[model samples]
Target chain A: MKKKLNLRKATPWLSAIGLFVLWELVVRIFNIPPYVLPTPSESIIVGWQFHEAIWMHAYHTLYTTLAGFAIAVVFGVVLGALVGSSRAIYDAANPLLVGFNSVPKVALVPVLVMWFGIGTVPAIITAFLISFFPIVVNVATGLATLEPELRDVLRSLGATRRDILIKVGFPRAMPYFFASLKVAITLAFVGSVISETVASNVGVGYLMLSASSKFNMPLVFAGLLVIAVMGIAMYEIFNVIERRSTKWANRGNPTN
Target chain B: MSNSFVELNDVKLRYSEGDDLALETTNMKIDKGEFIAVVGPSGCGKSSLLKLVSGLMPPSEGSVIVDGKEVAGPLKIVGMAFQNPTLLPWRTTLDNVLLPMEIVKPHRHRLRKYRAEYEERARKLLATVGLEGHEDKYPWELSGGMQQRASLCRSLIHEPELLMLDEPFGALDAFTREELWDILQNLWMIKPFTVILVTHDLREAAYLADTIYVMSKRPGKILVERENTLVRPRDQETTFTQPFTDLVHELRSHIRDVRES
Candidate 1:
């Protein structure tokens, strides 16, 4: 059991290093030229060579991603709370939200670019658009699942609807909000990259697009790795927060 | 009696139009600071009685009066606890106990200004229920019995005039249930309030209540009302006494008859 745990802990690093080795070997044995697919070493070396420009692009991506996520958080929670509280609003809004989510967010990037011009704003809007759905859904579920007994007890004490929402509804949704943040943050990255590739010129997605156009496959691969690392970093941050704020739910009675 | 604190006069109830009557025409008079228990077979409208008296539901046919006014909606003076221990999972035991104060009228207004006073009252109640040091712990972190203790505190903290309980100890183990009975009786002895506890346990009704009312099956009406002669501060020892056993037996026989018919 201890050996298994040790291996489990090592799996992520091992998988990462093994993937690099496999890519390097595949390139060497197949004698593939750098224009088509560069080895892991070549990608790293090229990525390091243009570190300053890559760094600038990465910074731009992070800034736009965070700005979009912040806006999504505010709008998603408010909309979710509104939808979750009343049966009428939930009924009216459910189908509309599901329909909007079904349409691939990438399809909207071109329209956004047309309306807002080719730049950071469109990318940020795309990130905001793709990420808010999960937040709304999770937050809604949190409020919807409140126990009937809890509602009855509060109402018996003359608690108004607003009092119930502030005291119980919002606080109970904290863990769910954080869970959605982790999911929404990663999706926000996907949105930003998609929009940047289609419209913007300053982000890592734009840099990768230019690199691909010029047959600089190594630099494009470097941009992909940077996004992966950033996504993992953001996920880890939210995971820690979710565990901290909602530890009570997990610590429930063992017999239960 | 003219001095009745809660008086139900020929009350009849149906959940909605065309539905079967949930409770039949019934009348009851409860004096101030009295403790009563309503026991019946499952689906016997015991809970419906609680709702009607607490003003959570209005009767279709008769007038229900409490504190000299007809109850139109939920009264501000009632505090309730349920079968399930519904302590807010996000809040600590102390905070959960302090919750009703943040909702009930006069207390709600004063709570923000006299935070320490309310906390002191909550702490005292929690300690009485043997939850002294456990106040900082969250509801889910505590055992079932502890959570119920916290729930009891939540109901009483507002100092409500009418306390309504719907099988509050129904989910607990036998040992925990008995332990809470003593704790609850202890709390009541110090400062009496009007209480209406609806339970399925015959012994619980026999042991805790000043009077016990038995109800028949659905579209229920009162079958019998037996005044408890069991004295105050009754403990586990009292449960084994001849009077207590006879009282439990009497209630059990009535419930068995109701269930069969």
Candidate 2:
């Protein structure tokens, strides 16, 4: 079992290294130009050379993504609880939320830029808009699907509605809420990048756009790599929190 | 009737308008501290009787009186357990047992002030159910029998006057079920709360209940009420005796009649 766990831990890194080697070989064999398709090594070199600039842009992107995600968390929890509390609120708001969610957030970046005018605000709003829906949907589902038997137990105890909500509903919704955060954090990055590419003057998205315009393809690739790493890191953080806080939910499924 | 602790008078329950009645013209009178069990076929509304008596659901017609007062809504004086232990997955066994005191007042009002006292009561109840060392464990970590034992602790912790059990031991193995009967019997002997147990098991009904009620198929109504004459402090050895077997057989005949009809 220990050997298997060690192997599992090593597999992802080994596969990533092998992929980079293959990419390097393929580029070298094809004699691809740096401007068109830089080798993995070339991209790494360029990434290292531009580390200072990349770090600044990465920081801006991170802040905007986190700010938007934080807002999404607050709004999603409150709205999800309200909608989940009754069938009437769910019925009244569900269609509007679905319609709003269906509209691609990419299209809204321009309108946001027009209003907020090419800064962190548009990127933040874009991230908020894209990520909040999943949190709301998951949290609402968690609250809504509370077992009828459990509800009956509380109700028969002369527990008030507020008592049931606080004691059972909210705690039950937590696992779902954490699950949504993992999904939403990735989407939050997507939203921020989209706005950065279209409207913002700073961020990894803007850096990539600017680098690609100058035919610095290796730098652009490095920006993409940075964004991917950041996304994975945030996702891992939430995953750890989810596992720790809601271990009981996963007791039956120990393999997770 | 005036002396009855829980009185159901011509109770009729329809879940919704234009729907068939779940229970029709059901009348029952249970004395205080009586261990009453309702047994019937599936979907026979045996559970509906327990619900009405607990005031979890109001009767569509007529009234339910408990302790000389009409039941308007859910009563604080009742403790309930179902076939599924239904302990919250998040809470430890001790905390799950203490859940009633966290909600049902005057305990709810005093919970913060008397946390240690309540925790001690919870621990004692868990000890009674053979769950002393398992108090800190989560519900999922425990076996079904252990979880059900903890659930029983949860139900009785608040010390409610009325205990409502709906097939509480139906999901357990025979040995576990029999063991729980002894545990329940001891608890009842010690505290003497009024109990309304609904089950399909005739032997269980005969073993635990003072009065065994047989319900007809839906829309259900009481068909027979048999007073158990088997001696008190009943155990597995007593179950082998002729009188206990006779009581079970007699209840079985009533159920067979109801099923055939």
Candidate 3:
């Protein structure tokens, strides 16, 4: 088990380094202009050189993404529960959810900017719109697909509605919730970046736009790197928290 | 002592407001401390009978009287185990066993005040089922047989007046199923609760039940009721003996007859 885990841990880093090495080799071999795609080392150096200013921009994007993600989570979970527990609500709202989900959230950026006037609000709204659907869809599906036999077992045990929700429904929903969170976190980052690109002047998306306008490709690459790092870091944090809380679920599965 | 601990009088059940009867005109009466096994072909409503007796479901057209009162809703005095262990995966084995206490009233009202006592009761129930050292383990951590044992422990933890088994050991391997039958026998021997076991296994019914009820398919109704005639503390050894196999075969033939009819 220990050896397997060690190998599992090593594989990702090995793949990442290999990819980086390939990128650098390809760039040097082709004599590609730095403006087009900076060399791996050049991007890393740029990332370091602009660390302070980049942190500020990244922080702005992070806050908007996080705030939007939080709001969406709250709305999605409550609405999901409402819809999930009722077939009528589910039927009524599911099509709307799909419709909204398919309406590329990026297209809403200009509309949001028009409504919210080029501030953090538009970025946050964009993130909320982009990231909300998965949480809703995942949670609603999870709640709907609850094992009937399990429900009967608890009901027979004299568990009230509240008890069933707290004990069975909620915990059962966690895996799905976390699954949605994984999708949501990445989408949250995308939403923030998209919004900043279109509207905001103070985020990693803005930094990328500013760098592109000036043709500072290294700075743009650095911004992209920071976004990637942030997305990965958020996902890891969520995975760790899920692991700690649901240690029971991790028992039999080696991969968990 | 009560003459009939449980009585189901002309019970009828349907899934919805206008649906045809799922179970029809079923009548049953069980004595105190009686271990009754209900066997039937699939969809025979053997489980539905247990549900009615346990007050998990109200008979649509009959009075389900337990301890002489019409069963209105889920009865607190009943414990149940299913084909699947259904142990909440998040809870430790011990905690899963104590779940009823935390949710069911009388115990729920006092659980926070007497938590240690409840924990001890849970531990004792687990130990009785040969799961002493595994109290802290999660459901997924345990093997199939072990999880089923824990599930049984959970059912019995609240010390209900009635114990309901709905094909509880059906999912287990034959050896493990036999082992559980004995474990269950010993537990009932120690403190006999009015047991209503639902199973597809005729052998299990013959072995565990003092009285075995057989039912027919779909809109299920009682086909036969046979008294075991076998003696108490019947162990695994008895299962292979001529007398027991004869009883099991008799029940099997009855089931076959019901299905054919």
The global C-alpha lDDT for each of the candidates, from Candidate 1 onward, is: 0.91, 0.92, 0.87
User: Which parts of model 1 have CA positions greater than 4 angstroms off?
Assistant: A1-11, A25-37, A252-256
TM-score of each: 0.92, 0.96, 0.91
Docking quality class, candidate 2: medium
What TM-score would you give candidate 2 relative to the actual structure?
Answer: 0.96
Best of the two (2, 3) by lDDT: 2
- List the TM-score for candidate 3's chain B: 0.95
DockQ of each: 0.65, 0.72, 0.56
Per-model C-alpha RMSD: 2.9, 1.7, 2.7
DockQ for model 3 equals 0.56
True contacts kept of each: 0.85, 0.76, 0.72
Candidate maximizing DockQ: 2
- Scored by lDDT, model 2 comes in at 0.92
- lDDT per residue (tens digit) for residues B109-176 in model 3: 99999999899988888887889899998888799999999989888887778888999999999999
Best candidate (score: lDDT): 2
Candidate 3 residue lDDT tens string, A1-256: 7898899999999999999999999999999999988898999898899999999999999999999999989998998787777789999998998898889988999998888899799999888989988888888887888777777767877887778877878788887888788889899999989999989889999999999999999999999989999999999998888787767666766677
* Ranked candidates (DockQ, high to low): 2, 1, 3
